[model samples]
Target chain A: MIRARRYQDARAQARSNPELAWWVFMRVSGVVLIFLVLGHIYMTFLLTSELQASYSVVVNQLAQPVWKIYDWLMLTLAMLHGVNGARYSIDDYVQKVSRRVWTKTLVYGLAALIYVLGTMGLFIISKAMLAG
Target chain B: MYRAREGQWAFALHRISGLLILLYLLIHVVSISLVLFGANAFTVLHDIYGFWLFRVGLIAVTGGVLYHGFNGLRVAIMDFTGWGTAVQRQLWYGVLAISLIGLLITAWVVVPRILAGH
Candidate 1:
């Protein structure tokens, strides 16, 4: 966790290249995700209630390449961003080295599994739509 | 416990909401991915989520997203600008105000739908 008050300070504190990269990645990804995620929530939940989004409606949307790409972008970016943020927290609070490694392994494993699952889901829906 | 002034509270809330959102994201990916099983599988899960309990939980999720996003921007501002650190307290209040307004607007749109049981 780069606990610097300024970008220069963050750069100064960064112990390695990857550390600096992640510090920059958080800010960049965060700004992008703010728009992507909030727009997703607005469109999917607020603009239209989830109750109205039945299975067929979901299929219809996902069948489109556009919505597929949109969702996949959100899924990929949000997962990476969220996972990295979680890693920071884990580094902070999880003190014991062995326990921290185990915890991080579990989190990263789960995140990778879900990312693949979500990508498969997005593509599979289009195929299902075509076959039906 | 140390005295948690504005910055401490902001940091703590950011961590909590970030973790909560990550937990939700894990479940969300899995649940949505059930669509691959077929419409029946998808609809079954969807209906379960349509329960009022889950719907209300989503409203809280919206609130969490707003706060986390806005506070994130505030953090970025503080990191990039010198003056941002000087007025971090004010920026934190602004973050709260924006989050509250967004939550209220979301509730206004969603509460009625939840009430009608649609």
Candidate 2:
């Protein structure tokens, strides 16, 4: 029996270069973020009659795994994707190739640090809730 | 060198908006999660929706989500395909309309719920 082999090259290309996918995704995601961010801000800053949302409120909501994961996904995607975008900007305007590279390196490092700290903070808080 | 103006803008905004949105999402989740963790920590969000300022904020958040999320989708497509440039111009308008509609719908749902004070 003769077997047909899949076009592994194209698939690999697509996987390696997700540019096309991300392009289409930007429109959809951007539109969605507009709503998500606006809703989020309003709820946090404007809606609460109380000037501050108590810590208890925060912990209670974080307990839901869905929300936790939602946050994690959002955080990771935005940080990585956004910084990646910034790297492009640096490349476009910044004349020096080395500068662009260095800037991106720093930007990426900062993003990583923030992600680490933020995740750790959440984990500690989460564990505290469970321990009690 | 390829002019990455649009692409770069998309990239920068993706990060800015992504970061902004992430903070909000985190807080949002945690706000609600606190209730699950401790009985004493249970904070009812019922009051939040009712506040006028929060209502407006919700509308803006809805706007941000639509803009940032949808725009992110647009850039994502552009990276891997050549068709990205062609669609960007038209899609911006399309995105705007969709966002408006979404905001309206959200308002419709949220207003009654909040105003009724349920």
Winning model by TM-score: 1
State the lDDT at B34 in candidate 1.
80
Off by over 4 Å in 1: A127-131
Error of 2 at B33 (Å): 15
Q: Chain A TM-score for each candidate, in the given order?
A: 0.93, 0.66
lDDT by residue (A2-78, candidate 1, tens digit) is 88989999999999889889998888889988999999899999989988777778887888999999999889888
Judged by DockQ cut-offs, is candidate 2 incorrect, acceptable, medium or high?
A: incorrect
**On residues B55-99, what C-alpha lDDT tens digit does candidate 1 reach at each position?**
989989999999999999999999988798899999999999998
Clashes of 2: 90
Give the lDDT of residue A42 in candidate 1: 98
- The fraction of correct interface contacts reproduced by each prediction comes to 0.81, 0.20
Worst 10 residues of 1 chain A by lDDT: A123-132
Q: What is the overall TM-score of model 1 with all chains considered together?
A: 0.96
Candidate 1, true inter-chain contacts retained: 0.81
Best by lDDT: 1
Listed per candidate, the RMSD to the true structure in angstroms reads 1.4, 9.3
